[model samples]
Target: MAGLYVYSVLVVLLLTCGAVMATKENDQIIKENNCETKMGLPCFLEAFTSIFETGSISNKCYVELVVLGKVCRSALVKRTLENPLFKDLRPATIIAKSIQTWNNCLALIDSPSPSA
Candidate 1:
């Protein structure tokens, strides 16, 4: 019974150590990703407000917003996937679609206007 208790305690200690190491690695990744620099909340809010005020923004404006939104979303999705906190969440497909949509919007934005 003493031997079994020792084994169990050792197992628990190992698991705790592993968890701590994983958390440290995740923190390093988060720091490297520079979440704040990549997605400034104030900038996003300002852009959103501008879009809302426009009532009916042009395609170019919409495309620009979409590009920024997609970049931000993709970064967050990637960070979440990397972080242990959200490790249980399945791999994301939405980020890929967001990138595709942003690309398509950019193409449209680049194309000449019918009158031009």
Candidate 2:
């Protein structure tokens, strides 16, 4: 009966571990999907770490904006707005632009716009 008891414990532990892993995966998927839906881009830091880390298109664009002192957050917001895929994003274009201006101003106190 000792063998049976050990086997039962092993089975229970395995099942518990499996359940935990499944839950973690589900949570990650939900987070990634939420980020994608809101941003109109893949979940770079979450679902597509390799792409982001390796400087894929979106990642490269983000880095460029940051380096240019262009307010990365506004650039991301503009990207989401300009893309037809994220048409359902909230606050309207006017509000989005206002927010972008605020973000840019908050970050870029020196020159505002180099190209302007």
Candidate 3:
């Protein structure tokens, strides 16, 4: 029950942080800039940390999202979006999934121990 509470709080915190990683418009920007990437857990975590620790999205990251299409692309997403049937919704879905994946990765990253 404690773990579940923590998880729920984490999600709520994430949602309340004004995370700009939402919306179909962002998806379109990501697609237009061709900044999509196939990043592993570590890479995604690092990138997210840089943003979250600063309490906002950095200009470089924002520009990448808006002008360069630098989104967290996955092999699975690539394969699925390749199907023409889902074209209209593909970009937004991939972006949303990538954000979800990154959040999960962030949760698993150990916080620095005070003893250290």
lDDT values, one for every candidate: 0.55, 0.45, 0.47
- Poorly placed runs, candidate 2 (over 4 Å): 35-116
- Model 1: clashing residue pairs? none
Candidate 2: give the clashing pairs. Answer: none
Return whichever of 1 and 3 wins on TM-score.
1
Query: Model 1, stretches more than 4 Å misplaced?
Result: 42-116
Ranked by lDDT, the better of candidates 1 and 2 is 1
Best by lDDT: 1
Tens digits of lDDT, candidate 3, 1-116: 99999999999989856433343444665566444453344444444444323234433343333332224334334434545665675567555755654454444443443584
Q: Give per-residue CA lDDT, model 1, range 1-116, as digits (tens).
A: 99999999999999999867765665565566554454346544543333222233346555545555553545544545556665664554534544554565567777887984
Off by over 4 Å in 3: 1-73, 109-116
Report the alpha-carbon TM-score of model 1 versus the true structure.
0.39
Pairs of residues clashing in candidate 3: 30-69, 33-68, 33-69, 35-69, 35-70
Model 3 TM: 0.26
